[model samples]
Target: MGTWSARPFGNDSAADWAYELDEASDWGVVSDALRVAAEAVPSDLDSDDAVTAIAAAEVVARGLGRVPESAGSVDAFVARVSAPPPEMVALAVSALAVAASAEGELADLWEGDPEWLAENEKLRSALTTE
Candidate 1:
């Protein structure tokens, strides 16, 4: 996570702030970067593949932290993440959102991603059964 002062975004709701942030930015560049960086992620992600994707996503998320917390920043961050399947995308978004927060900035980002952990477990289990 990058540096962000403890300043309110002048909005009453955090969700609203995040929504506005997403709408204000040009996310194409970020999306391209994410897609290109995550190109190595296989369709059937093993643990390592999942780790790779998560790492790529984290880099993008962390980069976004440098910008002010606004709709544009959210848009840029979300756009850069190349997670497919609505579930994976949601997971990515949630994880990124948490990591982008003040508390998350001070904590280990991946360690807080329960969804990522669950997904990893699911993938690992599938690998063993197959």
Candidate 2:
């Protein structure tokens, strides 16, 4: 991924018919946007679908640099990300938390997640399958 800068969002995150993401000035709006955007998406960060949400939040947060470390070091990464504009941080955290919630996987499964996002786990395995 190219850094998660303040650069405009891509087709992956904001669809052609979706509402304008930046126009969201509060939680209700943000939640609405994410709901519309992630409607069919089965999972988060572990899923490209989820990463798309994280990236959308990053566009608003302007903390794209954290992408490199989000996986390797979550605490340091969240701390750095927590320092951004409040609206940005809150939105980012909300989106990420929702992403995590959607999948129900706190960390790597290292195996199948039969109860949570089995589809996401399947996709993840497919991504690195040998």
Identify the candidate with maximal TM-score: 2
Candidate 2 Cα outliers beyond 4 Å, as residue runs? 1-48, 63-85, 102-130
Per-prediction tally of clashes: 7, 2
Q: Candidate 2 on 5-124: residue-level lDDT in tens?
A: 221232344332124433433334334444433453334334434445544454333332432322222223334333334554455455555554544333243123353345334323
Q: Kindly report which residue pairs in candidate 1 clash with one another.
A: 20-71, 21-70, 21-71, 21-72, 22-71, 22-75, 30-80
Quote each prediction's TM-score: 0.24, 0.30
- Winner by lDDT: 2
Cα-lDDT of candidate 1: 0.35
Please give me the total number of clashing residue pairs in predicted model 1: 7
The sequence of per-residue lDDT tens digits that candidate 1 reaches over residues 86-123 is: 33333444333332332432224344566545543433
